[model samples]
Target: MRVLTGVMLCVLLGALDQTVVIPAVPAIAADLNGFGHLSWIVTAYLLTSVSCTPIYGKLSDIYGRRALLLPAIVLFVAASGLCGMAQDLGQLIVFRALQGMGGGGLMAMAQASIADVIAPRERGRYQAYLSGMWGIASVAGPVLGGLLVDHLSWRWIFWINLPLGIAALILSNRALRNLTVHRREVRIDYPGAVLMAGCVTASLLVMSWGGSSYPWASVQILGLSAVALGLLVALVAQERRSIEPLLPPRLFGHSVFTSAVSIAFLASAAMLGATFLLPLYFQLAHGVDAATSGTLLVPFLLASVAGAYASGQAARRFGRLKYVVLTGLAVATTGFALLTLLAASAGPVAIAALMVLMGAGLGTCMPSSLVIGQNAAERRDIGTATGALLLLRAMGGAFGSALAGAVLALSFGAALTQAGHAAGIDPGLLRTGFRAGFLACTVVSAAGLLVALLMRDLPLRSGN
Candidate 1:
């Protein structure tokens, strides 16, 4: 329980960091006179965090979780302090990148640590806790961020992490001390790491820049995409021959692992896309304040938690995850389809109910996929497997957000033009634009459902 609590705190801190900084962006930009580079503040952290996650996972497998995790927590806390004290956006961006370096380890290590203590079959129960923490953090982060910025200072958002982080560090250090080490005499894959990092950075940059800052077919985007593909090929070739590969190619041979990873990717794409678009629907279509829109999302978030808890119990009882995931994806697809039909006349109750269904479906899918991936992996590769799954999910989320934003922008513009100067928030155009975005999300969710259908039922291991 102590260990679980320690890891949960770590996960919460990591999760909170993702959203809390959003509200502070404008304030930081104004204070530092860096409106031009404002986006980098968020982009820097995301790039570093995503690129570093798999490396951290592989390191924990080699060096032990305690060795890596303790330093990560310390670095994260120190970086948080640095961010709080930054006088300029440049410094804050650097500090945030450093923070992401540490934040990358928190989720991978926390999940890996759970696999260390529990059997695959029982891990679902614990995973439910982690999922719940994320759900709460998702809702609380923006609210708390806004509050801190309004009531005190934007810096308070960074400072707020210090206390909780310090306590988490202390608890985790003590609780994780006695974990068994599997130290080996193998060298770290520096070349593979570099190549992998390059691949991730280029890929993310392409996604972030494509259709927003630059045209999809522009030289800058094409060059980055080519570089990312080249780096990926090089990384794969290097990993194949390396003594201790960063990501073992053998893991992919397991159909379960591959399928689980794919499912996670598609599910995350749908989940995040919907989460991003729903607020706009509420605010623009229904005419609500940011705070009220956030509050309206409570049903979705809470339903996710409930769904995770219930799914965990069901997985334990049945000792099989195939049906749970399939059912979840199907329901989520249905939810997204329903959302696509949403009209301006739709009431709060209708929206909330659809969100609940979608959230529950996502909740059911998330933990089951993790368990399947971990269970399919060899004990030695548990961290690597978990980290890879998470990395793909993160990328999926970024892609989903980008895709949704592009769709909304194009659709809304077209709808507005068709509305022909209809005064005061054209309900017809709003509905049309939102429906287009939701339809894309529905497609993503349906793809996830197809992937879920291909997953084979593997009995959960009773021993770690």
Candidate 2:
């Protein structure tokens, strides 16, 4: 229980840190003086996280989970201090990147550790605790972040991590004394890491800048795309010959691996898209404050916890994961279908109900899909397997966020243009854009349903 508590603390910090600063961003920007670089503050961390999650997973397999995880906690603490003491936005952004290395380690290492300590049959209950931690963070981050900024200084947002991190570090050091390490003689694939990072960064750059900074077809975007593609090509060629590859090339051949990963990516895409949209809808369409809009996510977060617990247990017991995840995807899509039917003046109750279904579906599908992916791989390859799963999930989420952002932000004020005189929203442009965002989210959710269909039956772990 001590180890569990320690790891969950790490997990919660990772979850909370991801969005805790979001509400404080405006204030930070005011002091830092780089409004143009606002996106980089978020993007730098995300890109680093997406790039490193898989690497951490792989390294944990070679080194020990505790060894990697402990340092990660320390690194996060140091970076948080750096963020709090930042003299400029650029310095803050750099520290955030350092912070993401820790975040990646926290999330994937904690997950892999859970599979280590708890038998798969009994793991659902523990997984539920971690999932609930996320629920609490999702509900708490914006409100806490807003209050800290309003009452204290924006620096408090970063400062908060100091105590939580130190506590996590001390607990981990005390409780994780018996962690078994299996040092294997495997060479680190530095080139593969660089190539993978380059590809992810390029893709993220396109998404972040495509619609706003320049058109999708512009030279800037196209040039970046070509670089990403070239690196990916080189990465594959390098891996085909390397003694140790970042990904198991055989994954491309295995039906279960390929299919499950696809489903995971699609599921990630849908959930991320919805998360982005709902917040926009809450703030823009309903004229809610950022803090209140964050509050409106309560139903989705709670439902997600319920679904993860129920589905994880079912998967553990049933050994029929494909269907379990598919059912989740189907139900989530149905919720989106219902949202499509929502009138511009739809009640809060209606939207809340639909979000519950969406969140539940995602919760049901994602954890099970991860289990399937991890289960299919050889035990020796658990690190690589975990990395592969995370890489796809991150990529999918990035794509989803970008796609939704583009669809929502691009239309700007087309709602007023279409309706002649505004009938539903007083904010006009902001409200209309958010509505379009939700509508785009519905389309993405429907796409996830199709991906879920491709998932093949795989035995869930009874005792991995």
Candidate 3:
């Protein structure tokens, strides 16, 4: 119980940050003049978070979860404080990066810890509970963030994190006390780490800047792309030779490991794409306020919680995760496709129904993927495995957001031009470009369906 409480708090901490910020983005942008760099608000944190996953993962393998987990929470709390105190866009981005550094640890550690307490079969049920918590928190975050931003202040969004973080810290100290280990003798792969971080950062820069800032064919974007490719090659070489590779290349050799990572990435792109655009639909398409938009998202987010919890139990009973996950992806794709029809017409009822469908599909897919990945991983390599899954998802999300942002910029212009306001409506109001953005999401989600169909069946655990 104590362990569950500690880990649950950690999970809540991460999910809250993720879900709350979606609704809070508009407010933050308006206040800070971050219209151009609004994507970076999300990007900065995501980049830093995945960048540190391997580092924290490796550290936990050597030194143990409790030591690293507690400090990571402290770092998160400290960064949250800094975030609330930020006076400018630059500072906020930097502090959010700090928050991401801590974030890299939160999900992996919590998941890994849960894996520790529960056996393989029973873990499914517990994972269900955790996923439900995630869903509920996710739903609550945007609604609460919108309310706080609309009625109170955006600063409270960061402030709310403190109490939750403090509780996590205290509970972690007690619950994780038994989770100690003797440090490994292996040298840290500093070179591999540097090269990997460089590769990831440069690649993201190329993607973010190309076709958006500079033309895709421009020298600047191409040069960055070339640099990123080179760094990726070098990273591979370094990891292969390193005594303790930051990312052990051997892990990817497992087909399940590779497949799990791929699906996790694809699924996150679809899910987060919807998450990124749904509020825009509410705010821009429906002409609703932030708080009301959040309220509108309740169906999707809440239904997702139901799906996750239910999927957890189902996975335990049937162990037929491949089909469950596939159904989810398929359902999500349908929901996304339905949105095109829903967005073109007028009706909150239709919009809510589609959101619920997408959310349920997502809830079904994610936990199943994570558990399957966990099953495939060797005990000592849980951190690396978890980190791989996490890193891929984070990158996928970045792609989804950047792609959606670019699409919004392009399609919204076309939409407005058709309506004879090409110059009237600001091209920067990607928020109002919800229809086009969601159409793009439907396409991305369809891609996830293909990935889901490819997921191989893992051994069904029956005891949960």
**Which has the greatest lDDT?**
1
Clashes of each: 0, 0, 0
If both were scored by TM-score, which would come out higher, candidate 1 or candidate 3? 1
Query: lDDT of each prediction vs. the true structure?
Result: 0.88, 0.79, 0.78
Give the number of the best model, judged by TM-score: 1
The segments of candidate 3 whose C-alpha lies over 4 angstroms from its true place after superposition are 19-40, 146-153, 180-183, 207-218, 283-286, 341-343, 414-440, 460-464
State the lDDT at 259 in candidate 2.
Answer: 72
Off by over 4 Å in 2: 413-436
Give per-residue CA lDDT, model 1, range 83-102, as digits (tens).
99998888999999999999
lDDT score of model 2? 0.79
Clashing residue pairs in candidate 1 are: none
Instruction: Please provide TM-scores, in order, for all candidate models, with all chains considered together.
Output: 0.96, 0.92, 0.87
> Across residues 1-464, which tens digit of lDDT does each residue of candidate 2 receive?
77788888988898898778888888988998878888888888888888888788778888878888898898889998999999999899999999887788888877777767665556666777788888888778888988899999999988999999999998877767687777888998888888888988898898888866878789999999999899889989887877877775876567787777887787788788888888777766666876687778889878888888888778667756777777888888888777756636669998888889989988886677667777777776776677778778888888888888787647664454465643443565564566567666667666666766765676666676
